[model samples]
Target: MIYLDNNATTRIDDAVLDAMLPFLKEEYGNASSLQHKLGRTAHQAIEKSRSSIANYFGASSKEIYFTSGATESINMVLRGIFERYQSIGKHIITTKSEHKAVLTTLEILTKKGAEITYLPLDNQGNINLSDLENSIRPETILVCLMQANNETGVIHPLAKIAEIISSKDVLLFSDTTQAIGKYAFDYAKSGIDICCFSAHKLHGPKGIGGLYIKRKTRPIQIEPLITGGKQENSLRGGTYNTPSIVGMGKAFELISLKYQEQTAELRNYFENRILQEIEDTAVHASHADRLCNTTNILFKHVKSAELMPKLINIAVSSGSACVSGDRDPSHVLTAMGIAAEDALCSLRFSLSKFITKEELDVAIEDIKSAVQKIRKDSPIWQLYKSGVL
Candidate 1:
């Protein structure tokens, strides 16, 4: 299959897999059991991986903490912060288009008295800085936002946002899950207090990710979500998934801006072809700065549910893979002022560095054919063609 859903997850890189093989086999020692030579070797490997990941983000090794994935990292950050600092303030600010991990966690926090302010997005899928500035109350403890959107690939201006909240006591937290490998991000310069991302999105092994908690003069503190062991500076517990951690480190080390640019070029070619060859099609968030590898297209009058099944050889998504099973329209699209019906007609195609121009061409032709066939049978398309309601 022609996979265009890299934002959901990427195929593991051969190098990353090779790096992980030793750990999965003979090097199977618990990182925390430091009394034995095997355990010491495992611990050293984990630390080395941590250092590599930290260096990629311009952060200190001490600031990085491993977790199962971005979802778990997000839960640990949101819930841990609320539990520890609810007495200082219970209010948190985030965008309405955040991944379900953040939204659903915030939902539970609400029951425990956390106040959430969901910032609105404009037609271009961007938040007004003024709206963010005005929403910060004295009780607001954190400003939670994602660096780049998973569905539309719309990017939030982190440096500007950091400047806005810099003077305020409120901490800035970002979900950098979709941004890390595809985009250039400097954790040290961004002034964000915390951020999270998963390795699977970057051609690394699944089930491994990291969270960065900034070390400031007056450091931020949060309760541990997983408690029991001394792992991760007591911030997280459990034996490390050594193979996955090593693979994630290799993945981070292998990130190349040149490759990302090439992928972006391919993505643009795909988008341009879809818009030019297919009538009544539009690209979502076209007005905003987006990740280089993503494009969400609106197949006007054609439902994605219908179009998707026809393009069986291509792997694309209507929205975030985490919520693909839900019957509702994409929350990200709807929040950007897209009508529910129009939102349902959109599809997200995210490219990986591994995809070639030849493959993209084939996928594009298949998409064009499938969309045309689906529209031929669509009553909505017929009404539009006749200029009738």
Candidate 2:
């Protein structure tokens, strides 16, 4: 199958997998134990991964904390801050299109009586800066937003928001899960206080991800989400997953070396083909800046769910894998004010660095034909011919 669902998750790079095997087998030991040879070996590997990830983000090694995925990392930052600084501020701000990891966490906090304001998005899925500014109060302690949207690949104006939040004393937490290896990110330069990412999105193994918190930033002081041992700077406590974390580091090293060139080509090739082909299809959020490999499209009369199955050879997502099984309309699109029927017709196609131009050609041909058939079969198209759609 031609896997275009790279945003949802990606196949671990063979080289990264190779780097992980020894840890999973011969070196399998609790990283917290350092006396024994096996444990020492595992401990060294985990520290190396932490250092590697920190260097990639221009952070000190101590600032990096590993977790199961971006979801957990986001929760760690949000709930941690809320619990620690409850007296500092009871209000938080976020955008409407954040991944459930951020939104649901905020939702739970809201239910617990923390005030929250979800800023609205413009037509191209960008957060309104004025709304963001207006939402901030002396009581607002945190502002959270994702660097890049998973569904549309639209890059949010993080630097602008960071500057705005800087004016206030509020801490800014950005979910960089989609932007980590695809685009350049500098936590210090951006003035963001906390950032989180999943390795699998960057061709690393699943089950390992990281959080970066700036030093001098208020210590994330929430009770541990999982408590057992004092590990991960006492912020996250558990024996590390040596193999997957090592694999994640290897993935970062390899991707960082070729990121600029690969991503430029990625964006260029996809845009060139889509512009030349794909009649009657509208690229969502095309006017906004986006990551290199992600493309979300709305094929007017076609059902994305129905088309996805027919194009089984091409792996893609209607929105997010988190909500893949749900028949309900993608809340993201609906929140952006896309019509319910149109939201059902939208598809998110995230390309991989490994996808060849020939594969894109084949996929585009498949999509074009599929759309033609779908549109022809659609009763809405017949209605639209008489100006009824």
Candidate 3:
């Protein structure tokens, strides 16, 4: 199958696998065990990997906390902060178009009496900066937003968002999962107090990701989500995931060496073909700055649920992988003011560095033919053709 769902997860890079092989095999040891040489070796590897990823985000090694994935990282940081800071103030500002990881976690926080203000998105899948500024209040202790959207790949104006809180004591947290390997984000320079991302989104192994907690002289006090061991400098508590951590470092090395430039070109070529061949198609967030490797499209008279089954060769999705089982229309699209009918008709195609022009050519042909076939059989298409829909 032609894999066009990189936004969900990417195939592990060969180099990443090579780096992790020894850790999984002969180098196996608990990083917390320091009495033996094997344990010391494992500990060293974990620290080196931590330092590498920390440097990428403009953070110190001590501030990077490893977790199972972005989901756990999100929950850990959000819940930890809320638990500690709820006494001072209980307000959180975020957008309605966030992933289930953020949205669902916020729901739990609300139950604990933390007030949440969800900013609405515009037609192009962007939150209004003015609305964001107006939403902030004296009791607001945190602003949680993602760097790039998972469904539409639209980038949030983080620099502008940061500017809004430049003088405020409120912390700024961004879910950097979709944008980490694809773009430039400087946590220190941008004044982002906290952020999280997963390795699987960047061509590394799953089951590994990290949270960046900006260090201060006084130290930030976040209640621990898991309190047992001393892993992650008391931020996260558990045994270090040695192999996956090694793999994550290698994934970043590969991105810096080549994947960024290659993937951008491939995405452009793929999107150009889709627009040229498809009739009555709408590319979500096309007018806004977006991640280079993603495209969310609406095939005007066809439902994506029906079209996806016909285009079996091309792997794609309707929305975030975490919420794919829901039969209802996407919340992200609805937040951006897309009609429920068109949101159901939308499909997200995310290209990666591994894809080729020849593969894209086949995808374009198969996708075009499938849309035509589905639309021909669809009564909705007939109504749209008659200008009655």
Candidate topping lDDT = 1
**Candidate 3 residue-wise lDDT, 193-308, digit = tens:** 88888999999999999888888765667888888877777777888899999999888767653676787788888888888889999798899999988999988978888889
Pull out the clashing pairs in model 1: none
CA lDDT scores, all candidates in order: 0.92, 0.84, 0.89
Give each model a TM-score: 0.99, 0.95, 0.98
Tens-digit lDDT track of model 2 for 121-221: 87788887988998899989889888999998889888888888887988888899998777776666888888998999988988889888888745555
In candidate 2, residue 45 scores what lDDT? 94
1 versus 2: better lDDT goes to: 1
Give candidate 2's TM-score: 0.95
User: TM-score: which candidate is best?
Assistant: 1
Off by over 4 Å in 2: 217-220, 257-260, 266-268
